[model samples]
Target: MNSPDSQWSFTAPLSAVPEAVNACLDQYFADSSKEFGSIGSEFGQAISYLKDFILLGGKRVRPMFAWAGIRAGLEGGGGSLSVPFPDATPNPKALLSAISALEFIQACALVHDDIIDKSDTRRGNPTTHRKFEEEHRQKGWLGSPEHYGISQAILTGDLALAWADDMLLDSGLGHKALHKLRAPWRAMRTEVIAGQILDVTLENTGSESVDDSLKVIEYKTASYTVARPLHIGAAMVGADPQVVDMLRRIGHDIGLVFQLRDDQLGVFGDPVVTGKPSGDDLRTGKRTALINLALHKGTESQVKKLRDALGVVHEEPEINDLRELIIATGAEETVEDYIRIHSQRAIDTLTAAGLSDAITSELVALTTKLNDRKF
Candidate 1:
């Protein structure tokens, strides 16, 4: 067994992920450009937008989780944990392609999400729709610029969704491996779409129940973001059924913690780091666990204040008051405690799986990095 310290020694810097994934994306685009012609050609603008949006910035967490799942699955087959180098496995290229597909799926989600949220920026750059809106205004296009932007953004997101499937099909996995991947792949897509619908419903209906909020988290963020990716990787390797189930459970816990942290950051994080104004969630009236707790525990006036602030962008001082109200109600601490509990639960699940040292160590490092992230 590798010691924890030694196991963690292999944890690659997060920065390395974008470099690796970007190379894959560049090749994907190069081949696509060959078939589709230049950026000015038919459907080329959407392709270029997706390329830039995906390659520009993201934590690349889903792909990393998928890769880790592959390692974990291989370990289950009694393989050696110390491989000495990356992509040294039997089916390295296929695995990388499959993993890279996750980013395209994520791109689809984010583009559609930005449209829904009416967000202007992502990763410190203009969102796809917003960028198109600006283009319409600059070009003096005929239709309403806002409508034109929405239409183009929708098409771009659809292109990403379609390409995600294409990438996976073209990943060079055997027929059997591809067959195995279908279940998780289809389920991931379904869950995210259902989750998005529920989220929009809750926002419109003004539901305050923690249970409802958690349901949204489970489908929208947790399953799509973590559990499904892990399962897909395990499927890619034909891992033991029991091992796959274990990863599903572990991924669910970690994914929930991941979203909770995002909710916190959405409200309290620095704009410079988070790449959005503080209290964006509050402004959007997203029915997060934190908000639920605040509503449940806050005084009547505080509840009123919160209700008033929800879905309406407020000035800094009002935003500060809302922040203070949430903090004063002790919701922040309670949510933090919940995060701690879930984080430990996930670690405990991972430890109980008795995975090889390398897999466990990487997962532990990922959990720590995710839980402690400021953005």
Candidate 2:
């Protein structure tokens, strides 16, 4: 268990992540460009778009979690766990390559998610599908701009997904470590797809049950976003089964808190901070926990207003009215309480894991950051 006075330092600074991941990404694109450039300039253009989309700003949360997991595994191997500023592991490059694969997976998801949500912007920039759509319009393309955009975006996501596997396979981990990666990697991919299907189905059916929403969270966000990344990292080091189980459990709770925060931000966070329009989730008719709670508790008129506002274009005043209705029902507060509960649950799990103090401190800090983040 971590003591009260334990000290922790992040082995790699968050600022270093972009540089490290971009190096690998740039190499992959350069190699890909050489091979695909012979095919056509269109392939080059698509690659460029993927490059830009990936290099654009993100929190790099998945990679950070993986890094912490690596450190945790290292610490569990009978060392003090506190090391110097750099070179925290035997093969920093291998770890970076393995973890950075998460970014490509994330890019694939966001690209497809933007298409599904009809989101115009991500990280304060035009989304991948929207970018292609605008390009098609500007070029006066022969096909429907929307169709062109969706088609190209789907292909781009496929490309990213393929490249993610390539990156992981080529990450220079031993044959055994790579073999260990297969289960979690496969599970992560399948679970996120299943979750996405569930989410879309729920939206179409207008189901707003809390149970359904939580199911989405568990399969969609929790497993892919946090649990698998931690598991993969722990696998990279061949950590003990008990340790891996503890990390997965901790990740489950933390992932829920992360998604809960994201749901709150969708309704209430600033566009500048969250990089999406206000009330975007409401507009998209996402069957989130907050929405389920509102539907369950809201008055008849309030429910009617919410139902009407969903899945439709709404003016600012109408959106604000919906927001007020959600808040008035105390759904926002209810979700907030869940966030607190999950956050503490995660901390408690960490405390009981008997991990090194330094690793525990870093995980604790991550939990706090995720819990309190506005974005």
Candidate 3:
């Protein structure tokens, strides 16, 4: 029963999701400041920074996914924007709370990831840690600026995580429903952190075999980014156990394709479109899908050149050469083939599981859009 209006509207949901997310975010800030008002002069400012980061401009895919999951659980009973899922009788306040929790968790992961990658900026702005360090410099703080920034970010991420846990517990979901929601969040945090660790360990270290790199993709990129978000959405609304399991399977296939597409974008996407430097991944020697493919299939001489060019941690023409090698080796086409295969798998899984017509159609369209995304 997958339909275009319902499933494809994942994009349309964003128009409303941020507003919902903000309603919850506002509540969180107000509560935190009230509780910790007397702690320090900087507490208010610190909390503001946290809020700002959550509101950072980018796709609020996670929160939307959560909302969709909740709605899907309700199973299509609602009649209007204000009360979309009439059958589920979902509490508006509870829905906002649950979505906001996912947003905070995402913020935590991004804050830490930016620091680990030494990324100066994110979402077209200075990272939280970097922004904090600049403030310290202006204030003439005594310690390492980057270190101070990282420390503050770590604490900020911790606070967001704690807030997420509290929000989930307070979501007004029944005890059993709350438990179901919490499980995925816990697993996602663990996997993302482990992935971050692996990502950091590889920096300036060396390239890993395809199998090892794929494992990192499974943990670091695919599962938490897409699969878990979809699961969280489903779990929130009390989707059936079997349906939830099926969602996990479908989500994983599409999620990996999503990341593989992203890896391609890192090198080939337009800077204006991607909102980042061109060939950024190559500059960082990121062991992306393209690189892994080239490694597995490139000629011996090509491999030698790649080893020299990759992970060099600098800007150079060599990156262009590396990009060419990726193309020359037909890795790009191979990667595209993989996208097609995985995306079809997602469609097959959803159809086989007999999702609602609206959801099934929407998921397929969304998968197609994701797999074909340029930015």
Instruction: Pick the TM-score winner.
Output: 1
Pairs with steric clashes in candidate 2: none
Give TM-scores for every candidate, taking all chains together and pairing residue i with residue i. 0.91, 0.90, 0.87
- The digit string of per-residue lDDT tens for model 1 on 92-122 reads 6566767788898899999999999898989
lDDT of 2 by residue, 150-201 (tens): 9999999999999899888887666667767689889988899899999889
TM-score of 3: 0.87
Better of 1 and 3 by lDDT: 1
Compared with the true structure, the alpha-carbon lDDT of candidate 3 equals 0.74
**Model 2 alpha-carbon drift over 4 Å, by segment:** 1-10, 13-19, 77-89
**How much is the lDDT of residue 355 in candidate 2?**
84
Quote the positional error of residue 227 for candidate 3 in Å: 2.0
For candidate 3, write residues 1-375 as lDDT tens digits. 222223233223434676666666777777778999899877677788888888756566667656655555545422122232334554566656666787777888888888778898777788989988999999998989989999999898888888877777776656656666678988888998898788667654765577767778888867887778778777766677777777778778887898888888987888788877888887877887678888788889888787777767455476677778889878888988988999998888877866567656766777788888777
**Cα lDDT listed for each candidate:** 0.82, 0.81, 0.74
Q: Sort every candidate by lDDT, greatest first.
A: 1, 2, 3
